[model samples]
Target: MAEHTPEDKAARAAILERGCSTPIKTATGVWVRCGSRIKSRCESCAELYRGDWAAIARSGVFDGPVDQYRFYLLTLTAPSFGRVHRVPREGGQQGRCGCGVTHTTKDAALRGMPLNRATYDYAGQVAWNRDAGVLWDRTRRRLRDRWESVEYFIVREWQDRGVLHVHAIVRIARGEAPAAIELRDAARTAVAVSKVDGSVVEWGAQAQCDAFRANGDGAKTIWYISKALNYVLKDVATDADDVPVAVWRHQVALGDAARRMRCGVDCVPQDCSSLVHQRYGSRSQVVSASRRTKYRSGWSFTGLTRTVQRRLRREWWESQQAEAGADTSAVSPAPLEDLAARSRRELVARGWAAP
Candidate 1:
């Protein structure tokens, strides 16, 4: 680690006082991130947050030796405004859009671009994004009322047509697991009405609620949700410099619309400026409040809080180190390349290296 200059130290101190982060410059000519959780702003912190979220979900599911929980992987999607470019299932398969081009994995332009940008519902898209949290809250409360004790981790994702959707991992007590169909029905009912402006917000006909019985280690479900989070984080692009030309144009349009749209009288005069600032400029993007806090109205938790989770994680790491004591014969040095790669990953995750 490079020694910080007086000015750097002062800036860091000020950031700490404000409960924020200050970027640091490294010797490798890369700017160390401030660990922002918004993927469009900081990929490194987004990855770290995803890993931590996965671990938290896993711990909630597998807290006991024997599998004793019931899990539901729920997907809630918004209604489509228009068709968009979709990659074919296989190499030789036909494309789904009018573009008639089978986009490959490397074709970033087709990922989130609309078939007709001018006809896309930019206002509805931004409104949905702003109201997504509210919808999730309603659905969560409905689930909790039925299951009694439930914990969930939800992620919001952007679709190929530039709309927002949700993916959630919901856990309930073992014997209290409701039928998948019933859960789906409840979720649908909860989302049929919008809490934002009393308008009907449909979750589309493609909503899914998959139930998984926790047997053995219960790692598969955890890994699946974690992978979904990874995808969501990786797909976010806010600036023209960070994405392909087509995708950049779409994002710029969305940003502009988000800055201008206003829904109703109670709504913020600006395009949810408070929500945008809270999401992009503060630690609220990653750090959630505990159930005991005033900000816990939305997603209340009955399992481990962040502080307890961190303590348990530290204890587990220490125990692993103790178990590996003085085992030079059993341990082998990692490859040089692997070590370098891991160092880079850690530095990036900890905001000491650029993404």
Candidate 2:
């Protein structure tokens, strides 16, 4: 790693002060960032977002009347249409997959392979991802009807089989959450009636809902949701040979099939992008809502939300300064033009000649 110059330090300080942008290296080798939230696309900004999430989750920032509210960790999964390559939950388990090999951590290639690619429901998998957000929205509405208010952070995870499911941290403003059975029943109702182009969609019957009392600072629930965000991956595999033969073929086929899928309303396409866009619009990665506020879109932050964000940014900046051994001693301010000249000189010294 190269040592940061005063210009680099200034740019980073500006980002910290604004609580936005990312640090990227410029042509002159100065570090800066545009502050994107997609983890796979930009790890630097994503880490900051993750920290913000953890802080909001653990700090009672969103939960009102902390003692009166309740929380639930809900995992809603797509129904299995066929067997797929899966890691064994227990040791010494063998022959579970068609490959008949006991898979270990070393065998990342075998993680999501299907026994029979031809029989796998690739189109259905894509459809499920598209509608998962709607199903969740309906579920939240149901919760809100019963409770005073509802706020949730939903994470979409790709199963080893390439199917999408959700792990949500659901918060109710007051009162005990309904029993798991009742919650599952409500979720089933929400899924069954959720329609795409007048056709009913289903979320399968494999919903898991676990409740947590408002106790002990709510660290466990916060940590669990934060850990869920960490599982988001940019790419499952780098090369074709990295995954099983069938899995690779299936992926290629899905890509080819998706390209042909239609976009816009009323097209009812089978491709992944088209399906997701048609169902959930362009933004579908994370869905959140608060009954108390008007902003209910994906990743939208309210006024209070901004305050929490700033807090997270301050904490991150302090931590970074500590790690870099930055001096805290005050120094006399330099003129803006002098600072610019210094940066230009450093850039020229580094071979970034002025144009």
Candidate 3:
């Protein structure tokens, strides 16, 4: 770190407050020369930064295939505008009525009637998209209440592919559950656990709607979760360089070329690159493209082995069963039934049809 000159301090305040197009000094006194875009930096600094980002993205964790015991897809979304939409009138007769009313059957009315008021706020939507990532992070932490024991949950990252969303795989410890009913209970409990202040919006221009889904099928679930997380990594950088404001540093060494490359026993020093080239001609071009692309693959977690992946799977399995038993034993069976009913109602209100 370096000390900032007085001019740097003034520029920093202006850049931060007024979005000035100049270099700004951070509080720690490091000068952040704001480029037109992240790519437009001082030549030396830009190359170093891009190379760093490229390295990380080329070898990031969330990109590769992972072994999971269970898989699930969770949907987290922002609420809609409160504007009214035309709906079919229910229980109407004479085919028409005064007040410009068009009559229809009960079923038609139910089908056509707007479920709720609609609203429109472009600014709110933009703001919500900006804050969606933060909100998801907070919401995930709030989910701890669903478990008697603290379960290990690691967020892969929010993804934006064909759709923009967040994905995470939670590893539950094993204990009691071995059936779908118990697993369903855990999933419901996980969904029910929510943050009170997760409004994500402070005013009329606020966005709402948050949800989650849990898969407890052991390794398959983890694989799916990893895949979901991979969706995000496929198109972005995963190092401090891409996120210059970051307060931490993450780096990896290549180690022995053979070991790092996972080369075969037959590979020799002089023929390694040539051997690899022979084995992957056009494929090398694809790898090169990935190297230049914004997406990253070198993060620590991405380097996990099947052994580690399986261990996590087993841990989550045990945790889930243990949680199920504890929950079942802690309360009366009648209360559980009541809980189930209420949960069903909430689900229905949220758009799921009743059984």
Q: Give model 3's TM-score versus the native structure.
A: 0.27
Q: What is the full ranking by lDDT, best candidate first?
A: 1, 2, 3
Q: What is the C-alpha lDDT of each candidate?
A: 0.56, 0.54, 0.31
Tell me the deviation in Å of residue 66 in model 3.
14
lDDT of 2 by residue, 140-227 (tens): 7776677535567666766666566777766654555567667656666665443554345567677877777656655765566666
Task: Kindly indicate the candidate among 2 and 3 with the higher lDDT.
Answer: 2
Q: Candidates' TM-scores?
A: 0.65, 0.65, 0.27
lDDT of 3 by residue, 5-112 (tens): 655555354334433243433333333333221333233323333343333332332343323222224334344433322323333334443224544433232221
How many clashes (backbone atoms < 3 Å, residues ≥3 apart in a chain or on different chains) does model 1 have?
Answer: 0
